[model samples]
Target: MKRPLLKIGELANLANVSQDTLRFYEKHGLMRPSARSEAGYRLYSAQDLQRIRFILSAKEVGFTLKEIEELLALEVTRDEKSCQDVKSLVDEKLATVTQRIHELQRIKKSLQSLSDACCGGDEPATHCTILEALSDHDAGSSLVGGKHHDLIK
Candidate 1:
């Protein structure tokens, strides 16, 4: 049975990505056209469609293009160790995400303390405690650590 080859536009439509996206993937060596028409149009096979889906799914899960490339390479050489390699990559990403969450939480707490210190008055900002704390180096350091609630008072 002959497999049907799809033009670039057709594949893009099926994959819900722009033609430029396909080109970019090609440029990045993440994907390749199965063949080219005599008219110079890029053509793809069903296997290409599956590969595009895999790329998109990995992206949705926060994998960078570099990481996705590693994953694709792993897929091509599957063995008993492949699962362990993938798990290690995911665990690294999870640790990074967890660290970022902690940093953001600390930032949020600092901002909340600054907001709570302010009276929200309509008066001029010349004597605002929030502004004053921001200008003071010691207070600013405390705010960054989220331990300056008492200092603001």
Candidate 2:
């Protein structure tokens, strides 16, 4: 006879994620493991464990669950096209990382300037220079230079 299946809670504990996170992964198509319990509990397999680990690793590299699903789908196809697709995905991820790095560098410079301004003459928060710098001027007179507006938007 086979052993009984693990419930969602047990499987989630084993995978080092909350049960809700596992459900979210399933909902997002990053994981499509079978649900065998009619009472509506989620059942998991060994492959599910590996897939969860794969999701965690992908997240560490900044891949969204959508990206993970795309990558996993390609991997399962077992075709020469899989290699080409993975390469394309990696290239896209690299460009995203590079863009993020540039944005971070710009943010760092802005923060440094703000900090330096706030530190000038040891002014108190009630009259904070940084706060003054952050105030919205007339659009044509804004001091943000060329920083992208998406962060505020």
Candidate 3:
């Protein structure tokens, strides 16, 4: 029995994505339709549906589109080796996420310190510590770990 080819609308509906998103994926070569109808409408097969699902799943797991493209480029001919390769890719992504988390934490601390410096009282804005700190290039740079702490006035 032949599986019916799905039009772009049907595939987008089934995939829970907008038709424009499907076109975007297709335009990026991330997901290509298996064929086109005589009228030039994009047509997808069951395999295409699965591929789109994989791409979406990867994105949800924090894979950038370029990383997903690299993943898609990986040729897996054997199960054991393929599993190892996939694991390596996952490990790399995890490391990237961990580094990003650390950077965000540092930024969070800096922002909190800045916010704490402001009393939020009825005092004139001219005397605001937060504003003063911002205007002081040396102090501002040091807050973000720049090499200007020694230059603080």
Candidate 4:
């Protein structure tokens, strides 16, 4: 512990996060109270600042709050294998991202074909290829398949 631990506002500023974010992290169990001043203000140690930095970095790489919380929980428990678990979680996230990219490509191709068939400015509504493609289909009809439609929804 260091002398004169920082107050909540000072800690938030040092962490480059808002006071609200600090509160949210506490609520989510990612952060814990260090100590309290005589008037009931929260105090944070040097270790708390380091933890906040780690959390923000993780978030920037697409780790959700829950994921960060899991990591924090592991740290709290002094789990030796937590580093391995982090790598696993990152690999899983990368796979999900790749899948999403492929799905987006499919949706883009579908929309392009339909849209290219109709000139945006000159086409009459009834004769519009986009309109025809859409209107000709029944309920649940889309140029794109169900998976891409589900994404749009």
Clashes of 4: 0
Any runs in candidate 3 off by more than 4 Å, and if so which? 77-153
lDDT of each: 0.76, 0.69, 0.76, 0.72
lDDT of 3 by residue, 1-153 (tens): 989999999998899999999999878878889999999999999999998899999798677888888778766566886878877876886777786676566555545556655566344343245444444534434344343359657
Q: Supply candidate 4's per-residue lDDT for 21.
A: 90
Candidate 1 lDDT tens digits, 27-139: 99999999998988898999999999999987885779887887677542357667787778767867866866766665555566566655774544433454454444345
TM-score of each: 0.52, 0.50, 0.53, 0.50
Regions more than 4 Å wrong, model 4: 75-153
Clash count list over all predictions: 0, 0, 0, 0
Candidate 2 runs further than 4 Å off:
1-4, 76-153
Worst 10 residues of 4 by lDDT: 137-146
Residue 16 displacement (Å), model 2: 1.0
TM-score of 1: 0.52
Instruction: Tell me which residue pairs clash in candidate 4.
Output: none
Candidate 2 lDDT trough over 10 residues, lowest sum? 130-139
Number of the top candidate by TM-score? 3
